[model samples]
Target: MTLKQQLTDDMKTAMRGGDKHRLGVIRLVLAAIKQREVDERIELDDAQTLAVLEKMLKQRKDSVSQYEAADRQDLADVERAEMTVIEAYLPAKLDDAELDALIAAAIAETGASGPRDMGKVVAAVKEKAAGRADMAVVSGKIKTRLAG
Candidate 1:
């Protein structure tokens, strides 16, 4: 089944199991997906769905940091929980070794020789790493590699 269908199934399972927290997170994901579809006037494929989940995960991460900075452990915990739920649906993350390999390949493929070519390298990496790696981390790696 598609990722969207999996989310719907998980939502039903959460409801049946009386998992309020999981259910709420699943609903939040579905709502975000729906909102994007409505705004774009098109259906989202698995890649687009993953993008939405990633965006939500990033927002939750930011919230967690802000809450922790304010000494609000309870709020931070909630955001962390939501982040965990969202992460469960994302593609497996690339580890340091795999990420490095991917970055090297992207740089080679794009013939990026210096920082000026960073954008080209990044665009290539983003296409290959989408849903499988964090773009921010990938970008940082690209910068470091290009600079040195």
Candidate 2:
């Protein structure tokens, strides 16, 4: 099934199982997906849906960090739980070695020799990595590779 369909199915399962937390998170995801579709006037494919999931995951991670910094363990735990739920929908992430290999290949493919070419290399890496790797990490790696 498509990712959207899977979400819907899981939502129904959550309801049947009386899983309040899971149901809430699933609804939040579906709502975000629907809002994006309405705003863009188009249905999102799997890749686009994954993008939304990644964005939500990033926001949750930020919230977790901020809550922890403020000594709000309860809030941080909630965010962490939400993040775990969100991560279940994402594709398998690339390991460090695999990610490095992809970065190296992107740099070579784009002929990126210095920091000035960072954008080109990043665009290439983002296209290849997409949901498989974090863009922030990829960009950092690209910067280091280009600068050194």
Candidate 3:
């Protein structure tokens, strides 16, 4: 099933199971997806849906960090809980070794000779990694690789 369809199915399951928190998070995801479609006037493919989920994850991460920094452990815990629910829908994260291999492959594929070619290499890696790896970390690694 498509990601959107999966989300809908899970939403129904959550409702049946009386899991209100999970249901709320799933509704938030669906609403975000719908809002994007309405704003862009195009149906989101699985990749686009993943992008929306990634954005939500990023927001949650930021909230968690900010809450922690302000010593609001209670609020941070809520964001962390939401993150757990959100992350359940995402693909497994890439391990460092796998991520390194992907970076090497992307650099080879893009023929990225140096730091100047960072964008092309990063784009290639990002496409292959999809939402599995963090791009900022990948970009930094690529920069270090190309620099050396």
Q: Could you say which candidate leads in TM-score?
A: 3
The residue pairs found clashing in candidate 1 are none
**Per TM-score, what order, best first?**
3, 1, 2
Candidate 1 residue spans exceeding 4 A from truth: none
In the range 18-125, model 1's lDDT, one tens digit per residue, is 999999999999999999999999999998999999999999989988999999999999999999999999989889999999999998998989999999999888
Model 3 poorest ten-residue lDDT run: 122-131
Ranking by lDDT: 3, 1, 2
For model 2, state the Cα shift of residue 89 in Å.
Answer: 0.4
| Per-candidate clash tally | 0, 0, 0
Q: Give the winner by TM-score: 2 or 3.
A: 3
lDDT of 3 by residue, 1-148 (tens): 9999999999999999999999999999999999999999999999999999999999999999999999999999999999999999899999999999999999899998999999999999989888899999999999999999
User: Could you give candidate 2's per-residue lDDT for residues 32-63 as a string of tens digits?
Assistant: 99999999999999989999999999999999
- List the global CA lDDT of all models: 0.94, 0.94, 0.95
User: After superposing candidate 2, which stretches have Cα over 4 Å from the reference?
Assistant: none
TM-score of each: 0.96, 0.96, 0.98
